[model samples]
Target chain A: MNTNTQTTRLYHSTLSPFCRKVRLVLAEKKIEVELVEEKYWENPPDLKRRNPAGKLPVLRHRGHMLAESQAIVEYLDEVVADPALMPRQPLDRHEVRRLCAWFDDKFNSEVTQPIMNERVWKKITRSGYPDSRAVKDGLRAIKEHIDYLTTLLEARRWLAGNAISLADFTAAAHFSCLDYISDVDWDRSEAVRDWYATIKSRPAFRSVLADQVPGIHPAPHYAELDFG
Target chain B: MNTNTQTTRLYHSTLSPFCRKVRLVLAEKKIEVELVEEKYWENPPDLKRRNPAGKLPVLRHRGHMLAESQAIVEYLDEVVADPALMPRQPLDRHEVRRLCAWFDDKFNSEVTQPIMNERVWKKITRSGYPDSRAVKDGLRAIKEHIDYLTTLLEARRWLAGNAISLADFTAAAHFSCLDYISDVDWDRSEAVRDWYATIKSRPAFRSVLADQVPGIHPAPHYAELDFG
Candidate 1:
């Protein structure tokens, strides 16, 4: 069994939205973590050892190995109660989780996964060249997603509700990854742009903003807090 | 706004593992619910109105709309705490969630989705014919998954631990769907077979046992309590 310690460490991939969500939550809760980037696609022996499921964003804290980005983020929020990432009411909490799934599951399949697979993973993993059709489809899908998010933001202060919750972090994580590759059209939705700018300027986003993926340059405004 | 009543209604599909999971949880909690079968692929007008994500397994309770199977199940466990689906300790709870994700995300992708897409959805949705390669791949993947689950059962009575938690229900949900199409080769792993038999015998599983998708038939042993 791994010994318990005050230290927290996360095994992650820099460009993964799932990993970024965990990082953002940890940062928001003021938890210090040592980030170790793992090349999970190569079937690293330690990766499966750390998480039996062999997934990224495996967090080792207080002698427990936590996997599943949503589960880990919720655990972090529970353990660190001062800045709660989930709302108090059950109905409101359901909304937070529902939206989290929207981004992690739906948005990812529709936009982030396909786009990254075509433009990013192909280059990083030495796979075939980008498929223009897949990229075009992802770009097209993202517009509808942005419009949906714009509608959500127009009513609520944050994605889930009035408070800044894990849903915002989850959505931002996916958006940031697409933004890194300059796939997002900032001119598309003013509401979404404003929401992004507000979240991007937070202290929790600093480390993510500083992410430097090898051989793939970030967009010029990727790290700029005042991009809006 | 929908009127609040004593009624708890679930909008779901027969073959969906996610819907099965919610059914199992609600039944375990002894919450009486009305199951409404929905053709989500057809994108019925009320589907999006009920839940903006337009996903199945949307539970309507006390006039609150709940989407995302995991979120709904968790909410049910929280609100109806008599037969708690989640463990008490954070570590144990994390393990439960991790295993839940294991079955829901990894196992679903590698086994259920591929197999179901080929065998079931194509027939129901009138899409292309089943790809033999995809079905073969899903069958091949389930072998390794069964082995893994067998190992976990060797160490612990249940998938997550000694107690039957949401992980067990989540896993059984997926397995039940595959079993419905007579896809599972239960003879491969005695341990997994025993686990399924144990979960399947529970009273909560009765409704799922009685499920009959149109034009598709359940295996002979699907509803048998003494299948083991």
Candidate 2:
């Protein structure tokens, strides 16, 4: 095993929501990390050797190689407990995890994955032209997600509960990716817009807001703290 | 609103891997639960209202409605400490969670979901006939996964580590579903076959081994404890 436990490094892609989620959590906990952009789609041989799953957002921290965004974030929360991203109660923790899944699995399949695959990835990878139908469907599905977030925000201060948890950062991670492309129509729900604005202005969100993907230019308001 | 905190009820589908994972965990913890089969594809109106994500398995435990399989299982482990399913250390816990994601996300997408959607779901829902191409691809994918499991089992007692964890149950849940259909090539790797046999004989696995999805007959050797 490598004995260089002092340095922390993250293998990530700029616009990938999963990567951004890890970056956000790491930043929130005030951990310094060296970011290395990985072109995972090219199927880097070393990636598979290092991580069996061969997925991104792989963190090399304290001599351990960690993969999976949720697992990494939860691990970070456990090891570095200063600003707890998870709640104490099991039931409350369940809520935080449920919403994380909501954004990562459900919302991702419905919105982010489809839209990004068409709008951003295709252009970056030179795979093909955008599929209008897929983009339209993703755009259509996002409205439902935004409305659902409105309902949650109406009842509580944050996405999962009153205290900001990994759920909020998870949701923001996906939204920021879309927002970078100007896909989110912030006008649909003022509550969600305000929530995004508040989260956007945070110190933790600075690195993410400043992201500049080479081929894809971020929207004019992408980095604005007070876009609303 | 639910005064029935005394009764633990799970809304699930018999053949779903996610539902089986929850069932295995609940049984391991000895939590008595009433399983209600949900035909989620029919777009059960109440599923949406009860759980915002509208997915299974949704567990009503201690008066709180819980959704997301990983969230529910982790919650169960947290609330009921007997026969601990997660390791205490942060790194070990990360390994468990990462392996759980391996089976649930990667294995499900590559092997279980495609095979089940083609072979089992299409037959149950009467949507269409089995697509041999999809089934073939899933079958091809399972070999690589089984090989990876073999590599892990060679060094450790269980999938994630020595102690049987949520990783084992999570893996068994998916494998059991596919095994029900006689899809697994038992001869592929002796290590994996032995590992499955060991996990299969556990008392907690009885409920899952006894599951009978309507209109789908299980493979002849599915529930046999000493199949090897």
Candidate 3:
């Protein structure tokens, strides 16, 4: 077997939530991806060549370019197909996929929007103007999303039912970044908080926590803050 | 034998690209999911309860809730485990996943952004101010995205190469909508245009073509825009 098939090249930024999602999946599958940090905001020609839409966390493997965190992670799970991050049931797997999408789509828009804009993206894109209205709205949106999360965590140990499936990683990926900004009211929703704490403490999560923004300082408790 | 354990429920909208993706997978699998039309825009309590984010195409199977189109479709393939949308090798699987994510994420932003924003979301959200600039930007984004896609299609019969997979379906789902708005410059990429023609003619795609958005008139030749 040609070793080229084993090569996983991920074009991502440490501050990008989507990149972290792919990273966690790689860590889970014990697959090594050569991480290339792309300055997405500056719009590199190489990055645009990899992903025309200019989104972060594009995975190039097996001589193919994979864009979208969901597809990248699922591809990882499929190729590895061991230590499965998803349940075997068709329905159960769907459940995991659904939550992964939720994190990337809805949660990112509502929760991560302001934090990234106010903290990293604004600086990178050099927008220079921070909309206090957007920041306030994002904080409020986080609370609502958290309340919904509370209901889910109330009955299950993980974000998507009982297992440490893709859903948990997806949720944690987004939340970890918000936690960095201290945007997460970790005190609310003890079950969810505890669940996050456990995920944060995982070996896979250490790299995500280690991610730093040049102009942004994580909350003093950011590193030490554990869930629950 | 209790059939409920094997049965599936698809909560979706007839007009949604994400929902149509699930429909394509179901058609491919020949596994039936009781179709549940979800009014994602209405924000019905039940739908919101099932999907706190209030998105469409939530799949419920064997007492589990699956949200997000990418996750739901993969979950379906996983549980069904026949007519695999993924390749046998790990690297090849990554290729498929990457392609799927590409169409769903990048294509959504580039192509579907304008059509959905102009035709559906604007009407639903009642955010009356529609920026022609954004619509123009969306159009421009796709031309570039299509060139990249055309390059990929040059070497492969389908989006992910070789066999029909999630990538093609995801692309078709978005393109079909763009076609509705007469937005795609099909002449720009003969390969992509022909590939789309091939997809829209699939047995599973019949329903999608037949669908009519409430207040929008699809291109006159849309139904007849066939590859064959």
Candidate 4:
């Protein structure tokens, strides 16, 4: 057990998109953090003590245990000024947040959650066999999401706007998770594929790219910067 | 159809806590909005056009259709400035957002969504009869939440801290929905009940108090300021 209470530590699961978002932001902001993989599925007793909500991606920073990925990332952006993830104008910020919610809530529910539950979690937790129907549904849903992203990319340089904001990282986080399991059809949309390639090459994404979840090997092109 | 595009409009469902949270913030800032009730259950085709995510509480303001309740409220707070709902310090803001997410995500999942799905939506959509077991589960889950709120109230004047912020509104939004159906056991925690009373009596709460959903009458004491 590390006795240093001052050290910024993140309690997270490697494959969880929420945790990965926080990790990416922390890296993007050049903040040093010790990542502690938390098996939230087991209902770790201390998880409740650390966070009343008892959710993952809890950050122990500056004596505060921060929970909720969006809140934590926003806080980091606020505290650390350089390379800001949020935009200046209220409307721009709203666009960023709206997209963040879109990915976190809608995309997660529609694409990530069902597929991850079927493929990754069921295998890791030994819960059950993957439901092909659920996986197929998630795969089908991702096509629409990819099309939407392509449309957005055509209009703006990034998902929310011209600049690469938290929305990009958020969207990338979900895509990366699915990509790890070889679920994403990178060839589906040229623009989305290009966007992912651009974001994937960022230094901030390095830590995430190097992640190794036991028993689940990364897809051949998962960490390839030029893949697809 | 209202031709006044300049007039602010809110596409919402009366019972949705997400929409109600945005409404509370708008009312607190005294932003007059034309309420356009959207029967999202029927999958209004334009809902997708208005908001790609196709969720309700979509606010059409300043010619932009803003989606996501938290994002819209935060944007309102930023643009309005007066009657600020967010705290000053980054830490304080984070606390407010954390609690807001706690209610919106955690509380909604455990308490609001299940109960409303079984008790309210089923009846409204004529989908099926209420499932007593699901309703009971939500009712049971809410007790733990009330207890947690009681603990938080013991330490601070509001849900986040000494000052009233979006956290309070977010929490009150969910509670109000449950309270409408006479689901909340206000007797569980005096502290929580008192908190609700304080928030309920605010002028901003008027429109929400007056809400009347077709085929589903509110509980007799739902609108009473001194209900508990």
Candidate 5:
């Protein structure tokens, strides 16, 4: 593997879906990097300087620094020469980005927000009681997003296209976190469920699945579900 | 140019920030296409078929289609080869995406929302009277966002790096809409004020800047402010 494996540092958290997406991309690209776990809540000045938006998953490559998941993925795709995670054509690539944005924006807001906020943020932010209404809303939204995913999976082998792209990694990253809280109904959408199983079983995703978020315990089915 | 040109169609509204971002990208890339102005408030089935999320600025590239401003801009960047709107480095690109997301998510929510809702949405959505409180809040937030951009512009020639990237376009797109309502204080931050002026002067931006939203009239300073 001639991929650039020099002192690339990924400042990420074990539980963040965005960080997990970058980690998955790095693994698939066959690049090795030092993963630095970030305490985003602590409001570290160095991390804040690295990302003014003060979000997780800031990547340091060579001397340049970057702060968004999609941008980081695109940069990785560009800097490395092999195993493309993005498509070559304009439209096909658009489809990949569209799905990636879908997961980042809508799915994160709808499905992941409720579950993560309830299960993780409650323990992390350490504020307010876990409202049942938000939890129910998130659960309901997750089901709908999964149905949409199922529709995509039925027509395409992968989430966005024939081969595994950044889109699949992004979706699985979000769902995996929700799965940690047991918010997702795995049986609800078989096609999407099956697609996720395959993505989870990938060698690239091993570290992400194995990541332990301190006080939280992943749902029991998290380890049992098989993609193969 | 060897880049492939498809039957590109943009489903957009002149007033939407997301749509304006796509329009700016098309201008930078110099891509020619049909612009289908969508009346999103009507909930047209055609628009829903293109984007189930019912969002603005859905780009149709030949057989493939994409929703979300970030995704559509990226596709246009790839398909049209001139004037690259994104940086080559992973980290720099991340900064661009992060800022773009900042504008789309934070600025829009914190600043654009209050202004649009109070100013245009009341009229467009036909809900009720625009809230003065929200309008006042939006005005306050816009100034802060401008200051943030001032810091970024102080260090670099463009928002993300030495050259103009999509980050500038995204910012300008938002401000242009705000400028439509005479909401932005152009003199507050000179650097940001100038940056927006640069984009507004572009031939691609002329059409968008010239757009009239029926009953609204822009301040004279909007078209006159200069960054240089």
Candidate 6:
């Protein structure tokens, strides 16, 4: 364990969308963090000690242990204002948060969790063979989600509104995870593809695009800036 | 079908913890909201139109549709200043959010969802009879959660800190739902029971106490202030 109290440290998993959201915000805000990949599924004894809830994406900053990705990202935005992830107006901030929850909760249930469970976790944990039915359901659900994003992007520059905010990063975080195993049907919507392409090209997204999960390989176009 | 946009209207379900959390915060802020019970499980056509994600607890305030319980509650707190639900300090606010997620995510998954699904939802939706194994597992999980809350209350007056915050309401939301069906073993932890008693006695909790789902009955001691 790195005992540098001055610097921030994050314990997270590679493909977990929740952890990726925090990492995106950290990188976006230009906050240099020491990333420690934690295999929380194995039930490490110290994991519960770090976070009583025993969840991942735990951040240790200024000697305070912060759990919950949404909460941690919001804290980072509050403390560091260089590139604000949240908007100034309460309504706009609410929109940002609503979309964040949409991805973290609804999208996760319908798409990320199911897809990852079948495709990624089954392979990594050696739990069982990938359930084709679950994977198909997740794939089918993604089309509707992509269409929804396309509708949102048609009216605004970002997920929440015109300005780039936490909503964009939050959506991108989930998309990046799904993209890792080539689950996303990028060809379905031009608007969504454009939106992802713009967000993916950002310097903050570099760390996420460069991620390689031990045996799993990223899609051919996962790292490309001009994939479209 | 209330067309009055002047009055804040919340389309929600009676027993959902997410909806209850929003209702609690709104009541805490002294915000009089018109509640319209939505049958979200049936996926009403307007539900998808109101919230693209097709979830309940959609708050229409100032002609803007707001989804996501946590985000909606946070917005209400920000917009209304009296009896602030969030602390002023960044770290303190983070603690509040962390606990909110702890209940909404962890507690919901472990205790509320399974127990409610088996005991309440099955009955309400007329799907099937309660699954004993699932209910037993959920009941078993609650003891550990109550113990954890007992430990938290030992240090502070409230869940997150000395003063009442969103964390308290978020926790009470889940507990209130479980309490409705008598799923919570309040006798397991005196500290947790005391904490619940204190929060449950507040005016904000009245709306939750008055909650009546169609066929399912609330526990006899559910509404009593002196249950302990």
In candidate 1, stretches whose alpha carbon ends up further than 4 angstroms from where it belongs are A1-6, B1-6
Could you give candidate 6's per-residue lDDT for residues A1-228 as a string of tens digits?
Answer: 678787799999999999999999999999989999988889988899999998998999998899999999999999999797789898999999999999999899999999999999989888999999999999999999999998898899899999999888888999999998888999999999999999999999999999999999999889999988
Task: State the displacement of the C-alpha of residue A69, model 3, in Å, after optimal TM-score superposition.
Answer: 2.7
- Ten contiguous residues minimizing lDDT sum, candidate 3 chain A: A1-10
Error of 5 at B148 (Å): 2.7
lDDT of 4 by residue, B114-211 (tens): 99999999988989998889888998999999999999999999999998999999999999999899999999999999999999999999999999
Global Cα lDDT for candidate 5: 0.82
The CAPRI category of model 1 is medium
Which stretches of model 4 miss by more than 4 angstroms?
Answer: none
RMSD of 4: 0.9
Best by TM-score: 4
TM-score of each: 0.96, 0.98, 0.86, 0.99, 0.90, 0.98
Show where candidate 2 strays beyond 4 Å. A1-5, B1-5
Q: List the residue pairs that clash in candidate 4.
A: none
Candidate 3 scores a C-alpha RMSD against the true structure in Å of 4.0
lDDT by residue (tens digit), candidate 5, A1-228: 223545788999888899989999999888877888878788878987887677888887775677778878888888885888888877788888888989988899887877788778888778777888888899888877888888888899998899889999999889888877677788887887788888888888788778777788877777664632
Q: Against the true structure, what is model 1's DockQ?
A: 0.74
Candidate 1 TM-score over all chains jointly: 0.96
Off by over 4 Å in 5: A1-6, A225-228, B1-8, B30-33, B87-92, B224-228
How well is each residue in A49-133 modelled by candidate 4, as lDDT tens digits?
Answer: 9988989989999888999999999999999988989999999999999999999999999999999999999999999999999
